[model samples]
Target: MAVVKISERGSFRKEYIRWWKHPEKDIQLFDWLDENERERKTLFSPGYLRDRRNPLPYGLTKMECGLRAAAALFAGDPQRGQDYAANPRRFSMSVHDHIRSLRFKYRRFNSKIGAKVSNMAYVDIQGPLLQKIDQLMLVECPEWIRLHFHWRTDPYYNQYWPKDQPTAREKPVQANAPERQLRKSSPGLVNQKRALQASAVRVRDGQNKANSPVMELPTPRENSNSGTTQVRSSSTTQEIETLASEGGHASVIHGGATNLDGSITSIQRLELLIQLRKLDIEREDKKYAAELQRAQVEAANRHQSEKHEIMKQLADYVTGGKGSTGGSSTGRDE
Candidate 1:
């Protein structure tokens, strides 16, 4: 499982999902889900696990960028964001409704919905919508958003608020959640975090070393009188070059390369995220399988017990009949 550690900046980070990614929306929604799940314990069940609704294995298909943007946009709407934070399922269902309406509207007038908008303004909404969403989240929300956000449904987020903070929502988003709990309760998770921490630290350090600007060695100078200059090969420079070559980062650092440290951080986070998501999916699948198996076993036992009871009743009926007949026959013969 991916471990969440307090970063150098002290914000919770999970893969590409940063706590400060989409403030007033993404972070809040993530927390809402966590708290809701914790309180209601309404996570994946055997039935849901078997069904296709919101399949367990997330990121199997990356969400279309357009939809992702639209969702972000929808959430960034101060009113909508608060509503969604209050009720995720209801908000999602509303999206479903809007999608249906749009599908009907577009399908009636245009055959090429992707290229043309029929009666609408834009040709392809994929980019524009995303831009608007980005603008709403990255720029407008912090300025214009109303602080009186409240949920009509459940206030799971508000329960942990402090007495002094005059905010609708409470709690500095839980840095460590279930995975955190697992670390405390399960030795395996603790060991796993340690191993992953060590590995990421190594990659981070290696990238920093690889990306460290190559120190400018002194350029060979021409002797004014002799018109010749001898270049002394520095063993230190040779060793550095050798190390770079051995590390396979020699060419990577040249030409003002992109932040190798940032890239490594992304890679490390992504790798761990994939592992954690897959593990979570695997665990859910296993849980469903176990529950299903248990149900089947219970069913089989109940059926066997019923069959035994029925057989015993039939045997008793037969034995009683035989006894009665024998007694009558003996009486008649006597």
Candidate 2:
């Protein structure tokens, strides 16, 4: 394993205190601090780290760390960051640790200049970081900074601000919400909802009406307003609506009696169908009767013709007509 090149400020401070306590004038302090102990500090950790890939160590270089951070921020989603961190093939946790360690190192390094170890030098790393942030296209920089963060006032941010959006604007008032509330609270809408609920209830009750015994309802007397009906069922509502829409107050209650009338209509239709079938049957029977009478007449005529033919043959034999044996004998005597 590569030996760690960095350490926490406390350890560096301890080493600095040790070096201070010792007196070997020939031993160089540069060699003591650098070759012996390299100095660094950052916001994320006051602890030490080993050989890493940050440019300022900061990353494989500033570019790689910036790329990773940019992708995390630009996607604006937690899952995107998770996916990047979870992938080992393309990522190095050591590299992430390096950037994390050096991200705000400049401020700490500046603090260290007048303190115990003045050897830990400052490096301006935020410029490259800001460049990466711009490349990632975040509208604004992240806001959480307890240390020195001068990048927000940088020239690039100032130039980019007015070029894309010139001025800060007032929050626009929402005008449509009150209208929506008014529509929802409208009297007509409430009545329509109630009517629909009633229709649904009627339909559900109608489904099992056969099992429920029907109670006797008062007979509905015919009124001049009989074109309309009060809502006994969904069908009755439709009838009332039709009458009311036509500019009439005509109202009536369709009772159970209407059901009998409907059945009677159906029975009448069946009777008509039966009468049509009977007419066809009677016509067929008459045709058969005509054919039978014609056949009987033809048989009678055929029998009479055969009887006449037999009688003529007997008469011819008795009278001794020509070609008979008596007729030939008489001719010979003549």
Candidate 3:
């Protein structure tokens, strides 16, 4: 009785097969299969619930959508949603071919095949038909591929483009086309610029703090000459020690120790740091600008060149262009 979503179709198949294979879970599997059967029949039969979320594309008819849904169910294998998303025209045509094959088989031989196996089950006046329905369903399971079906035999072969691999026409287009620059978009450039600006602002703020004045009080002098000279000498030594310590710290930032002559002041050293950071920001901006330019150029070439024309042609062909001779193949499988 579990309600299966469209995306979970493949997963349900896997679970169903796994549980059905186990002899111990026969009762559970049968009950689950019956629920699934009733659900599929109700959904695919006339007057099924219309799902707006998975609505059909602009050009596709309701019948086409229903047909594709049935094809997906009978497909019996995982059909990737990505394939349909990439190109619905190609996906629908493939589904059409599958349904055509199934319809042909249903009309030509399935009735007789079903009749041969009908005697295995008991029938009641008010119950289901006396047939091995489960076994019959297994016999009609669809294959993922048709090994012998060639494009030349198909009337609408030109419209059938492979999603997994590029065609001969597309190869040259791709080779000539420039590579996509995923990281070089406008948003990335703007983000880098903002970050660089913030860094520059921080560097400027640090420089301003380095230039701020610091108030100092003269060391207290002794009343006697001898004491005064001693105090003066001590104060000079302490000042020299403090300047040396400050210079040592500045050396780490400036890439070299301050000169003995004290040519570079703290303010000048901070200015140098600010200038270096500005240069780094400018360099980054130029690099990002160049990358963005290249990305724009690549986009223009891809959309305005021969590649665009080829894509348009393929799309028109798939949708059945006006006065177009190309149509579905009339031939049948042997």
lDDT of 2 by residue, 1-334 (tens): 1111234675441111111111111022111221211121111222323433444422243334334433433234343344444443233333344334333443233232211111110112123332322222111111112112221222121222223432211122232342233223222323333433443455457755333211111122445443442332335334433433443321221111113334211112222222333344556768989999999999999999998998998988777654687777888999
Off by over 4 Å in 2: 1-264, 320-328, 331-334
Q: Each model's C-alpha lDDT?
A: 0.34, 0.31, 0.33
| Best model number under lDDT | 1
> Model 1: per-residue lDDT, tens digit, 1-334?
2211223456632122222222323323423433443321222111222243443333211122223333554566653455445444444433333333323332322221111122122111223332332232222122111111221111222222334643222322332242243223322324434545554465557665343221111122344443221122233224333433333222111111122343322212222333343344656768989999999999999999999999999999999999999999999999
lDDT score for residue 231 of model 1? 23
If scored against the real structure, what TM-score would every candidate get?
A: 0.26, 0.20, 0.19
Residue-pair clashes per prediction, in order, are 0, 11, 1
Given candidate 3, what's the lDDT at residue 286?
86
Q: In lDDT terms, how accurate is model 2?
A: 0.31
Which 10-residue span in candidate 3 carries the lowest summed lDDT?
119-128
Off by over 4 Å in 3: 1-79, 111-137, 140-334
Q: Judged by TM-score relative to the true structure, which candidate is superior, 2 or 3?
A: 2
Q: Name model 1 segments beyond 4 Å from true.
A: 1-264
